[model samples]
Target: MLDHLIGRPSDNWKRTQIILTLLASTYLLFNGRTYKLPRSLVVTNRILKQYAPWRIALGTWLLLYLTKHTDILLGLDAPDPLRRMYKRSYFRGTWVLTALDAGFFTAMSIKPAWLRHLLSVVFSFYYLVFADAAEDKTRRVRASITVEHMRTSWEKAASNPILSFFSSLMRPSMTLKKVIKVKRPESSERAQLPPVQVHLYYAGNLDDLPDQTSLLLHFPGGGFVSMPPPCHEDAIARWAVQTGNLICSVNYGKSPEYPYPWAVEECYDLYCKIVESNGKVLGYRGDKPLKIALVGDSAGGNLVTAVTLKILTHNQNLLTSSVSSSFVMTSSDTSASIHESQAIPLPAGLIAIYPCLNFDLSCWMSPSQISLMRAESTTSLNGKSISHLLESKDHMRHQSPLSVEPDLERKSLWRRAFGLEANHAKRGTSLEERIKFMPPSMTDLKGANTSMLPSAGFVPRLAMTSRMSFFNDRIIPPGLMRAMAILYLGPHSYPDFDTDYLLSPIVAPSSLLAQFPKLYMMCGEKDPFVDDTVIFAGRIRKAKRENSRKSHHPEGDSESVTVRIMEGMSHAFLQMIPFLPDGDRATKAIGRWAQQILSSDDDTKTSMTKSKSLSNVAAIVTNEKDMIYRRRMGLVDGLYAGINEDSS
Candidate 1:
């Protein structure tokens, strides 16, 4: 069999290589100690274990990309000095996965069909069960936060010597000089959005810029548990410079402590306050009022849409009395002026990237979902003993950067930055719930009479890897994400919006959708929440058509709602800005799209921008096949073409 695959009789070098490969692979697969393995052995095993080029490529990409993605997620979760140490350990530990993938694909590459399936089903069991003895050597801690833990976390963040050491290791060794331009912040000021602190940023030379400016209200996502705008300083800085848009990012009070509705209420109130300010913002003097736009990723996406819905409905009672009683809207102009007023305004456009639009996906049980459920049992994001810390690192990053996250910088940085103690509001207590959902498989993928035995060239095997599924992006399984979404409100926070369509914005009534501003939405096709984004995109159009006849005022052809599903990408793919190639392109696309969305049509500006943005998207999507492996019945591009006059 080995000779058949190798194409000729084995030479001395080939014989020695195969013997060494088998010995090394057998040792790693059956070993009690994993860390002691050599890097050469691991790499060799990964490359030669599977004869099928496609399987090898899929496995290699999966190991590399998932780790990178998770690093971004964990980096945002909480700050810590130990990340580099654990990451180094994790980079070393992916050998087990490499070995496993190589072995599985090696079997599938064999000739006999029944033998292949039998071996696969048997190997699948071993992969999920017996093979998980190697827990992450990168175990920081596995505990919930209390007062003491919080105090210790603050110390860790504040201890300069420790932070410097970690920061040194964590700093980018190479720069994507082309992607990020270092522009000194000309000035920054705080806008009182009540409980929400909006950090307004501008270019260093504000006076030399054009008169009319666009204000971008930005929100960063950390599962709604943690992560503030300042944490995303690089992105905000680049965006402010790239688009020449004055940006204000909110540091909203979070859940667990602040609870549900607080963030959105603050956001809505802040926008109203900006409207009420007249010309009070620091760096001004444009003849016209700033063109207001709303943008957010993840949880921020949810808030962006929620606030927009509240404005559209004009529902004074949408929020609970306890929350909204003190929350007053002080718009000097009335309803008509809301549409026409230059001084006071409704947002010109709304942009959401992978917002958690649907909270009901936890119950979905497709074959892919089942596979994910089984997969999770083997590599739970939680638990010290999880062999796949690198696998879970992506999710762990989102949970917290440090073991305990310090929210207040006064107790943290000193009086100048923030005089107050931090509010360590968390979204949920139970992120470890997925470990229990062991999905039944193979039977679910039945019905096709043919066996999917491999052949010569690389096979199109997108769905089988940890990074992908038949119908979804296999990052965090839908079932697991749903659990996190349920827990996002935390125990102290009341999920009053549980049944309310307003909370899960996609489910909102079509009448409300029709009332929306020119909306631009996006999501990674592999994102578990992708369905939510796609459904919401379609709903906006359908709602507009439904309400147009009844709409006292219908949206004009120019008022656009657009969505882009970046191919070969998953949830939070933009988070990879300046690092991963896809992330870099996605970030650039977002900047160009934002500019085009808010650009004025006076003379050739709008048409020229539209053409430029469309061209930019074409340039970004270099390989269409890699971009979209699987879409929902091909509606990904279909929906974009149907709604707006332009989809750039």
Candidate 2:
């Protein structure tokens, strides 16, 4: 009779049992109230008020039932008729018991003032238990799409309240402005292009330089973020005068605001425009052009090389039709893969400084770690390991460069221009059809078109020569680089290019050296990045030799490439020049290197040669005066400061 009454599979039966049990628990709890209990036993009354017998029983039963029927609870199996009936009974019992516990607790707490005091203790204990369970469930549901909606709603509301307050307080702080001071060169020796508000500085006049020579395109390093400001004008102006070249320093858009492809495309667009406008003014007429090189430092170095590759792959018409030189990129990061390649570009000419690269969410610390961090030290955030976040299989693929396939047609064009057939070249087109359909390999072309494509076997043999080759490069590591290389070199693979193409060469000052005529690299003995630079120099030297052998061109033997290692200098010494005494050995060494690169008489030196000196010079010493001015102008202030000032 008891089993039939209690275990019946009826909804009303379950609800009735829950109500009866709740009433019995309430009566038992109050019955002891009339008899004064000891202080030690007082907690029992509070516990009883917080959790009635019915609630405890119902919760336990539900937990057990879910555990026993885990497959159906987890939606892993079809539910049997009996199981369905049991689940309904369990839900009804749990809901009724929970309502009773909540209602009774609320009512008792609202009654006598003494009861409220006792009930507060009971509620506190229950609150903790409930919070713990809620937190666990929240974590599991964090990845669910539904949670994102809730988060968005909360964020929107939170941001609104602070927005007006911040807006008012930010207005007065916006008075700072980045000043651009123009100091004309000693003479109008360097031609100055009309200032386009965007032009950072003017270097006198351009007409003074010889006609039909090389055009130097300079891209300064600021990690695709900050700029060197007007103080760099002295150095850049000196460079233009000394080299007798038309120099244009690009201030490309920077990231989090202008991220990824935006800066890259802007640089490429600017480059194309410069070549088109200046190629003729510089005296290169018709399809045959004069020497044009690209130069960049640090992040600019990455941009320069990536742009060069893009032009070579996508803008073949510009190369085949015009006369162009090599490229030079200095002290730049070349690792482009998402995984190992996230290493940020070191400051121009400073190897000790590492780039901040990873952007994974999991790289963030867990709640427990956060708590520990808060308790220990505020700076603990810097030491958190992103490796754990990057260890997931999904992250490995997402961060990898080879994960995405290149467009087939674009790949074919690039492969054909480079005089190398992709492994999958024959998959889509037959031999006869390929020969007939595809443009003739650049190897078979003459004159300007000879260098239209990169050297044969260049991509394939890259890893064999330098340990830092795509595969073995220390910053990149061998496994990831090799995997990417295989994918890029494979046939019909989608846009399988290396991210290194986005970084500057380890040896050169700028990626532009590949396109420019004269290029130089200066490394410090104590600098950690020195080894990679040495390896890079060796690779370029070998490539030059191979190209010379293939072409039999005496022009290839010129001193268009130079690599210098300064003794006793360290990374970021360039920025410390003002602090160093007049006779400081490091400062003198940097000045000397700067003078040598800027004053070199190698006519064959490409315009890109300026990158080595520009970056190295910038790193060796930054002008304190300029920094102060920048601060006064508030250009260096936090992000919103400038915006506030502008709005006001």
Query: How many clashes (backbone N, Cα, C below 3 Å) per candidate?
Result: 19, 47
CA lDDT, candidate 2, residue 465: 18
- Residue-wise C-alpha lDDT for candidate 1, range 201-243, written one tens digit per residue: 6654555444645667787665565666645554666677677
Best by lDDT: 1
lDDT agreement with native, every candidate: 0.49, 0.37
* Decoy 1 TM-score against native: 0.47
- Candidate 2 per-residue lDDT, tens place, 1-648, comes to 333667655657767778888899998877856347786668755776788789878987998978876875445664221221112323233223233233223333265755644453354345345643433332333323132222222122112233224333422221112232222222222225222212422233434333434455556554454453232333344444444455556655544345565566666655544444434432334233334445554355456555655554442333322212112122222221112101111111111122111111122233333222222122112111111111111111222222111112223444656787566544433222334443567434323311111233211110111122112111223332233233222343343132334433332322223333334444433233333344344444545555666677654633544555443332333322223231134334333444454344544332322233133223322333244445644754666786888899
Candidate 2 differs from the real structure by a C-alpha RMSD in angstroms, to one decimal, of 27.3
For candidate 1, give the lDDT. Answer: 0.49
Quote each prediction's TM-score: 0.47, 0.32
Mark the regions of model 2 whose C-alpha exceeds 4 Å error after superposition.
Answer: 1-216, 237-247, 279-294, 314-500, 503-516, 551-558, 581-648
